[model samples]
Target: MSYHNPVLLQESVDALAIKKDGVYVDVTFGGGGHSKEILKRLGGNGKLFGFDQDPDAQGNVIDDERFVLIPENFRYISRFLRFYDVRKIDGVLADLGVSSHQFDEADRGFSTRFDGDLDMRMNQKSKTSAKEIINDYSEEKLAEILFLYGELRNSRNIAKTIVGKREEEKIETSLQLRKVLQRHLPKAKEHKIIAQIFQAIRIEVNEELDVLKEFLEQIPNLLNEEGRLSVISYHSLEDRLVKRFIRTGLFSGEPVKDIFGNSNVPLQKVGKLIVPTPQEIKINNRARSAKLRIATIKH
Candidate 1:
């Protein structure tokens, strides 16, 4: 159950500004790293709830009276918390995207470094897998995911190639998909290109962006007054959504201002973007691209 190193371990949790007896939620409770840390800082009567859709995470759940592991997705944070007779929360933490263990486990198909099946479902029970996307999706849909999620410049050509190859033989595995686009992978940038392709498919399979939006939309209403939100995002896509949401409370367009010229937003940014230091990145390569953003409910 060695899930992940939990990037920004102290920084992200500290950003929560934990009150000894405050109730908190860890939306991505992979490995229970952050949750465990929160427990150490909680006093008597403090409660901590965690949510993780991945079955593997359940194995790493901490055995403590103060902690409750909700074996569900964070997108339904509010609903599940209500079932426990919990309404207001003092803080929430979300470590967005796939966990390190998911990528390292070849069978999961999250990493381009591994040669495994094309199964990139965050929740093992998910219906739409990376294999389905590559084998059944239309050329247009494939290209859209590649461009939007992977940010690949030649997404159209890549999608056309995948469609053309799948017509001859099913693209059932990660290596097969890579071999299909071999010509596109220049020797120098092969790994980078392939990683992008894998990322695009994984995102689509998990409906990651949609889930993130839904989870974030519920944060404001769930948090109590002066509640804090700490999020660590690995890529620009997730970071952008979080950054924009905290600043304007809207995914797009500016927040409307009153006659006094004050815009009404749900949360206010706590401080500047926090990134891993050189020491952290050296120890955990995954922390290199990580960005931590903290915000509090607007009064």
Candidate 2:
């Protein structure tokens, strides 16, 4: 599993409060790292289902009868698990954001440091790509994605530059895009700005935020009474959704109150936020921004 080094490995799994004989899931089963650890804690009767959309992950599938790797996105977690007669789960783990392997493979076009094609589709079969977004999307649409997803304030200027540059020659590679936005990238902040731009395009191409919302919406129904949810998010956008859902059971705004003035929240936050320790961050730089949150079925 050099494909990925699961962040918050022990802390995230411990958040599951794993039951020896209960069923569980690792929704982001990259490299099967977390799933393997879950199996180690499971008894003979325990079952663990893994979900991953990337075909590359199939290579790392566990050979245990107790483990089943579903070759689909976790947005369809409930539907796929039901195909196997599983209606409830004791715990579920999610390590959000792109896998280390995806970032390392230059051809996949995930890294800002690499000069590769503009393709950034997490599911290879998906049609949309960074190339399409950069070269085909309207200037307004491009600006919107950069502003919202990338958290960039000068997105309109960047979008205009991209459109102007592509008119002469199609922006086909990461370096080409970088050159198009040269004025925007100051030497001191070049890496941070480019990362934000890449993140913006990747999120839009993969519909990551939408998929996350859909997957989380099913958690209330998929979990058994007191079932645990352990999630590790690398960025603020994803973490906000998880935190809001766990607190209010809704992605936005306050929860509605019933006749008795009791809010109908479904999941209860289990503990304070968990971030990578200095020791862990030193060992794995990817863990630097990782934030782990745990929740369980609300009483």
Candidate 3:
């Protein structure tokens, strides 16, 4: 089966403005779609390092001296790059969120459509899983996760139901857990609401927001002068961070200034945010929510 079709492919690549011999990094190399494109624009000496936490992503790796696939999380991208003996790079591209392959694989339990194990860990090596969140977390913590991460309006009731049901039998599978929390869901909007709740749980399980912050903080140290960053965030939460970081060099708050009024920051915005054209979204509805932000280190 084909790996995921990279969302906003041309838009993302073009934003990078690839140099003939520049080094680049694809922080989330789901199926190598963007990595392959980066390689195509490179000269013989150019190199591309790709990172993916999921082992399943490696199955799509291409055999090329120009490409190096790292089966690790992008949160430690700087460490891995340094270990690989790459000190600085020309650009970085991050397409965040779960891949289509993960969702399609029902056993992974990332989607609401399937009844499977409640394991949403992107990297199986990781100890924390969705099952732990649902089973081990206290009622208060569970409600917080659903409300903060999932944005479920009835988070309190859902958490209450989960805690109430798990006492009788552990919520082992997605179906079992969903059935228990069914009461909190609106009858007419069950499907979409359930999906949002699941999304929240998966975000907490993966610690995605925290990982993203760490990764973004390292970008200034990772890039050479004028090095570009092209990030495609799938939801508002992720997009807000990316936008804020690019604009102010901090996840929140205004950019800091020196006594003399000079800004103290490493990155500068390139252009207004980009979203998918209607045609692209029509073909792949998943692309609809994607927001692409581009920036470059201070030259």
Candidate 4:
């Protein structure tokens, strides 16, 4: 039931500007680290709702009168909250991407270091998996995910190799897929290359980017006046979306200007982007790529 220490626990909660009597949410309630901290700062009337789609995360649910864990994905934040009669919240916190516990568990196939099944669904109920994506996706489609999600430069070649190898033998496991793309893994760049490959498949399996966009689109309507949003993303793709959504209120393209030169955006950036200090990165290597962004409803 132990999950890695929630990234930016203190910094993210502090950014929420928690009101003792406020209602809040921890959307990625892995191990309940961030939710627990927010609970400590809340008054008797305060409430904290947690959401996690991973069935395994249910084991880490906290026992408290003020907390309720929603056994669902954060993308359904608005729908589930409505079931609780919660229309608007004071703050929402999301520690994006895979949890450390998921990466550490070899069977999850989230880490490149482990040799395991090609199943990378964050939710166990998910029908699509990394194995299916690698073994069934067309070369063109595979390349698209690798280039977009993995940010791999040689994505087309990597996809061609996967399609070629899977034709000979189905790529069933992590090591098997790695072997299929052996030529791409140069000695000096072995770790990075394999990681990118895995990342691309995992993102596809989970439809991560799509889920993120859906969740963010609901934030403005879900938050109360002055409500805060704190998100910690480990990759540029997620960070870029969060950054753009905060600044422009759209994932792509610029906001249209009105006759008065005013652009109507739903959210505003709270402050400068935040990243882990070198000291923190030394303690938790997972925090190395982490970037924190905060935002609030435009008023």
TM-score of each: 0.98, 0.99, 0.97, 0.98
Model 1, TM vs. native: 0.98
Higher-lDDT candidate of 3 and 4:
4
lDDT of each: 0.93, 0.94, 0.90, 0.92
Q: List candidate 1 segments past 4 Å from native.
A: none
Give lDDT: candidate 4, residue 138: 92
Q: How close to the true structure is residue 72 of candidate 2, measured as C-alpha lDDT? A: 96
- Between prediction 2 and prediction 3, which has the larger TM-score? 2
lDDT per residue (tens digit) for residues 45-105 in model 1: 9999999999988899899999999999888999999999999999999999889899899
Worst 10 residues of 4 by lDDT: 1-10
| Model 2 Cα lDDT, one tens digit per residue, 1-299 | 58898888999999999899999999999899999999999999999999999988999999999999999989999899989999999999999999999999999999988999999988999989899999999999999999999999999999999999999999999989999899999999999999999999999999999999999999999999979999999999999999999999998789989899999999999989999999999989999999999999999
Best candidate, lDDT: 2
Model 3 whole-model lDDT (C-alpha atoms): 0.90
Model 2 segments more than 4 A misplaced: none
